[model samples]
Target: MSWLVTGGAGYIGAHVVRALVDDGESVVVYDDLSTGSAERIPEGVPLVVGSVLDRSALDAAIRDNAVTGVVHIAAKKQVGESVEQPLHYYRENVTGLQTLLEAMASAGVGRLVFSSSAAVYGMPDVDLVTEDTPCLPMSPYGETKLVGEWLIAAAARAHGIRAASLRYFNVAGAAAPELSDSGVFNLIPMVFERLEAGEAPRVFGDDYATPDGTCVRDYIHVADIASAHLAAARRLADFPEGTALTPSTSDAGRAARSGRWSTASSRSPAGRTSAGHEPSVTRQVSLADRARELLGWSARHDLDDMIESAWQGWRRRHG
Candidate 1:
């Protein structure tokens, strides 16, 4: 089956595209190259440069490529920027997805693997957040993701589309130096930038209520993220036709750790020390039980693996 990977040139998207291709699946890349580089896309993979908002472009790519499924990964994902430009976030993340769905429906494409975020459960007060955690998004970016899930669910119910919304936690690392995340918006890259500048990494808000007084989060490897997409895509491809699959929530993350600095310190190439204490924030485990039972999938990489791989990518780009 041919899969159209939207944003296939971006950090995580590029990894997903490679994984799909390595599995011997026919793949096509649809990206605008705004934040993504065309070079990241593997050789021989057809890349259709276009925005998700452009229906004509999306239609042409889907029809021409004979796309049977879609892995929607394109989005404006900055939290702070979403706060400053809520409309743009909604337009790009929410409206853009709507446009994609409409084009997919019109083209008779019925399978989707949506790239969602843990931000939908913003500031969970539980000890371990599961798929049932109540969604209370803290930022516009989070809101857009939550809304995107809603849209997917609605479309699935109405159009008999097979879909899964993978709510990813902190994604880090790289399968290769070229595939490493280049943005400094994430904690790993942010710390790498600070260390490269010969400065101490800043630990944000160490005063949060917890055991050590800093926030805890789950970080997962980018390669694992790509594997998850492949698993989900395969599941949808083989699902019985006309059977409506509810848009279920699937979480993906590593074991929870306290403080961005604590997580960063464990993997810092220079072995830098962290100043913040660990917080009591709820462990954001990705609740992979459903994925395991349904898709027979689970993460294989750990924190050290993620950090070391990410650091290698950082050095490759910065040096």
Candidate 2:
């Protein structure tokens, strides 16, 4: 059974592709090359260059590859950018996904694995978020992800497509330095950008419920996310109606930042004080055990491992 991986040349998507390949699955990569680099794709895997919004392209890709499943990862994922350009976000993320779904249905692709996000929960007051958590997205990017989930679930119910939606949080680290994320939208890369400019990593607000008054963000290894995709893909036959899973580490958000500054401080001249305070405990929003019980998945790397890998990748690409 061949799998068509949309956005497979991008950071996380490439890792997912590698993981599936490592596990001996036949894989095809579909990417637009907008943010995705063709070099990231593995040799011998077919690369389909097109937007997810292009129905004809998707059909051709699926048909050419004899694809039976899809791992949809293409999207515009910037929170601030989404706020400034909501329509673009909707058109690309929402409409692009709709087009893909329509193509999949037409092609008789019965299995789907959708790459979703933690942003769908917005700013939840809960200590932990489960699959059942109410989704009130604050940004257009998050809204698009939530809507994508709704679309996948609807397709699953009506079209008999087995699917999985993984709402992963603050993804850091890489399988290799070359596979590291180049964009600075994420916290680890954003901090690297600030350090490159000789500026301190800024903390927006500190008067929150956390011990150090910072918002929480659960960090996960990109490899673990890839493995979870494999797990969900393997178990898709079990979930006939499609399901949602949250792949997360135990330490999240503000807790991830404040608790692990020491790990980052070891290499930076700005040190632990760069964040403006010594490491302190903070409230964590755990992604509940749904993924564990169902997909048999859990995060493998720790915060130190995450920081170290990200730093190495940043230096390799930028320095």
Candidate 3:
């Protein structure tokens, strides 16, 4: 059965489509071309021009493509914009996901890989965040993601749908120049924008409790994100029939921080080491560990690799 990838023409979605295709899986691109570019879609893949909000379009695509699974990557994801336009974010992200879930249930598409976010854990106070961390989202965008996860979990329990929600941290870099993220909403691109204008990238709130007074984030490569989707899809497909996949910490722990961030502070050149904050005996191991154990997945790229690859893409577009 083929996979229906919503928002397949977008930056991250396009990467996911490519990864699925490379793995010999049949894929159909479903996108509305709102913030997504049609040109990002590869040859030999069927592109269905539609939105998740369009129930008829979603139904038609799933039925026509004989889709057995869905990799949902479509959603409004701007933190600041989500605050200003909370209603709009809810309608597009949460409501649209509900529509898609309904269409899936009707069409008998039982497997899903939902694109979630680290934003779900707003300003985490823990030394290491995991899947079971407290979810106190700070913005509408984050709330939408958490709600989406809840919806997926509920749907899975009620309808026997096998699903996985991948809570991605900061995603950066690209597999190719053309596939690089064009949006400036993310940190890497934001930095690129400042540098292109001959200005230093601003580090907000240097007085925070972090080691260097700057925030530390677990940045994963977009390519790694794509592979994680494939891994989750395969795991779901392999599950026994009549079994509903619960919200496993396996999917939630996909993007754990493997290393410390380097900073310009006097405390240490390379901030606190992973050894500094040892894993608690009572607390669970990292999400990355769970991912490796359950899905055979691990992130191979580091921060420097991500920055260098992103810089190449930036120069290709803005130079």
Top TM-score model: 2
Across residues 1-319, which tens digit of lDDT does each residue of candidate 3 receive? 5999999999899999999999999999999988999888889999999989999999999999899999999998899899999999999999999999999999988999899887887776675677678888989999999999899888887887888888777788888888899889887787667556655555444443445544445667888889988888899877754343322222233332322222211232322222233222221222566567768788777666677788788878887
Candidate 3 residue-wise lDDT at 16: 97
Per-residue CA lDDT of candidate 2, range 1-319, in tens?
Answer: 7999999999999999999999999999999999999999989999999999899999999999999999999999988899999999999999999999999999889999899987887777777776677888888999999999888888887888888888887788898998999898787887777677766666655655766667566778888889989998999878745454434333333237443342364434443333355343244366647778888877777777777898899989987
Worst 10 residues of 2 by lDDT: 246-255
Q: Residue 75 deviation, candidate 3, in Å?
A: 0.4
Better of 2 and 3 by TM-score: 2
Worst lDDT 10-window in candidate 3: 257-266
Error of 1 at 124 (Å): 0.8
Residue pairs with backbone atoms closer than 3 Å in model 3 (clashes): 253-287
Stretches of model 1 off by over 4 angstroms after superposition = 208-211, 238-283
lDDT of each: 0.82, 0.81, 0.77
Name the lDDT value of residue 308 in candidate 2.
Answer: 82
By summed lDDT, which 10 consecutive residues of candidate 1 come out lowest? 242-251
- Residue 241 deviation, candidate 1, in Å? 4.7
